[model samples]
Target: MQKTHCIIPFEKNRNFTGRESELTQLEEMLFAGDQTTKVAVFGLGGVGKTSLVIELVHRIRKNHENCSVLWIPAINLESLHQAYLDVARQFGIRGWEEDSADVKRLVQEFLSRESAGQWLVVFDNADDINMWVGTPTEQGTKRLIDYFPRSKLGCIVFTTRDRKTAVTLAQKNVVEVREMSEDVATIMLQNCLIDPDLVNNKTDTSSLLKELIYLPLAIVQASAYINANRIPFSDYLSLLADQEEDVIDLLSEEFEDDGRYQNVKNPVATTWLISFEQIRQRDPLAAEYLSFMACIDSKDIPRSLLPRGQSRKKEMEAIGTLDAYSFVTRRLANDALDLHRLVHLSTRNWLNLRNEWDDRANTALHRVEDMFPRPKHENRALWMSYQIHAQCVLTSTKDREKESKEWYSLASRIGECCLSTGKYQESESWIRQTLKLKEEVLGKTHPETLVTMNNLALVLDRQGKYAEAETINRQGLHWL
Candidate 1:
């Protein structure tokens, strides 16, 4: 038996914490059979797919002394080719030294031999499928997948953010790496932080982890910031809570992480920004959905709230693209989609960076307005389900958009809903805003302005401000 030759690029993470179950599952699957096992580990960027794979490969090297291991970063053609060349050099494959020699083919041929011994190969960051399987028009060209060696003694693993790529690579043998559990995330944060005492306050620790969405990379980034600034968990949490911009600024702070790709930015925001750009290039409709979704509340988004696509099929495909990237998840009971909170913030920041925030927000406002039902007695159940989303849309409206007719209409509908539901204070606020706008744009004597005044008076009356309500009614009548 030949000695195991491990070719991992990154050192094993000594600070790696948790993911015991996932490690166990990957171990079992890799060693389950002799007939060339293949598994793909996939999830959102910065969810620790690469870390988990690294851990698994290290375990494999320790447990199987005779098995050779190879790590290839499939980030691009150059990286993959370089990794294959390195493997060729390690194996001392003849002719690989020549520029004309096909290093990939040489490595592939050597691994396919029966005497190559048991081997495990990991393709890290295989997020781009077109590079592996050429696009429709480029089918005649040789693809990266063609160079992958097949052998009964070999096990292959892929880490990716795109579920479609994962499925295409490994079919049913896919493991999704979700955000770490609270307990695991807390432990990881403690491990990452230089000062363990900072996490002594359990409440602050929990709040910090929750705000980071328990994603391993985000937790690590937060810990890095806290460690660098010599701040406590509460202080970092306060900064995160200050405002959306603050949160984005914090997540955008880059730091050195030994376990990650050297060329990649270590910030949580920038890590996911790569995935966002890929989604935009791969599926523009999904990109549009993401932009629009960023302007509204992140949770409990009814499918009906989305703008209509060219067709139902296209709409579902767009949503499926978002789901494939783990950016949005569907609720089992209601089928409503919920975007990850951190992803939501990152997306909004991305839009702002591109100077497209207002356009997307305006689109969201108009979509909500078009779909928002009147506050009629029969529409109560429907509007009730949409109430929070309506409020979110209204809150996201800029001062400039507040003057738009759609804005006034949505505001009035929401206020009417509030009035019908006996939320007198909120109703009065919305109706007052609408009345001010109507009076400015359409004049105080317009029928719509009178209607808004009447609604405001009713809300004031409901709140026991009869004197003010009577005065509003007289003013409306005098204008008429």
Candidate 2:
């Protein structure tokens, strides 16, 4: 038997925890069929795709004595070219020392040969589709996909943040890396902490993991922070839950990891920013949708709440793009979309960094205002479904936005909805806000102002404040 030669760039992560099922499934797939195998492991940016793949590589090296391995960081065109050049040099491919030699082609040809033996090539961070498959107009350009070696004894693996890229490369043979289970996450958190006693308080440790959304990179980063600052898990959770900005700030803090690319930002908040920029450059509508989503609630987003694109098809396509990136997922019960909570916070920070928050917030406000239904009995189901999102938009509104007519109009509708549903106190609060805005913009005697005043009176009556309600009623009558 020929000896296996491995060229894995990173050492196996000693703190790697969980992922038993994924590792098993990958091993099964690699050895399943007689033909060459291709697999793509895809997920959200911080979900630990690379770490999972690294673990898989080490396992394969341990178990399969004849299986050689190579690792390529296919992050971009330049990196891909450089990795191929290194491969060519390592393989001692003919004429590789010459600048004129097609090093990528040389590496491809060498790997395709049966003399290369059973091998696996891992394309880590292969998120960009344009690099693998060139644009339609770039027919003359050589694509990275064209250079993939073909051999029955070889396998290919890709780790990416985009499912579309995964599908393009591996078809049905794809594994989606989702957030870790609580048990798995807890174990990983314990392994990562310098002081294992920090995890002794299981509740605080669990809360911290949940706040980080059970993402592996986030868990690692949080552990690093806690270790460095000598803070308890409870304190970290407090910072995370204090406010959106605090959460963003925590995720934005850079940390060092030996397993990660040195040049890449380690923070979860900024890591996905690369994918956001790519989406913006490739599909503007998808980017617009992301920005709009960031300004509202992260969960249970109704389809109608989003602004229409050129057509329904275009809108679905835009949504599809976001879905492909694992930033948003369709809920099983009602098909309503839910953005990942952490992605939600990070995207808002991204917009704030670019000074685009106000515009996007206004856009979200207008869309919800336009789609919010009246609180009629027949529209109860529809309005109820929209109620939470409407509240989210209102909560996201700034002080200046509170003065806008659009803001009050939505508030009035929500207030009426609350009234119809017997939420007397909540209804009173919304009505009060709406009435103040109306009174300021349209004066006390304006018909709209009177309508708002009447709504307030009705809410007060519901709450058993009959005297105050009657006083307002009499004042409205006097105005009339």
- Report lDDT per candidate: 0.88, 0.88
For residues 1-480, write the lDDT of model 2, one tens digit per residue. 445567888999998998989999999899567767999999999898999999999999989878889899998777877887777777767998895777777887888888888999999999989888875333444567887888888999999999989999999999999999998898898898889888789889778887788899999999899999999987888888787777788888889897899988889999999999989988899999899888778888878778888988889889989999999999888878999888898898889999898888988999999888778898788899889989888888788999898899999999999999999999999999999899898899999999999999999998899999999999999999
User: For residues 205-283, what per-residue lDDT tens digits would candidate 1 score against the true structure?
Assistant: 8898898889988888888888899988878877887788877888889888888988878798878888898899988
CA displacement after TM-score superposition, residue 455 of candidate 2 (Å): 1.1
The residue pairs in collision within model 1 are none
Scored by lDDT, model 1 comes in at: 0.88
Candidate 2: the clashing residue pairs are: none
Instruction: Give the TM-scores of the predictions, in the order they appear.
Output: 0.96, 0.95
Global lDDT of model 2: 0.88
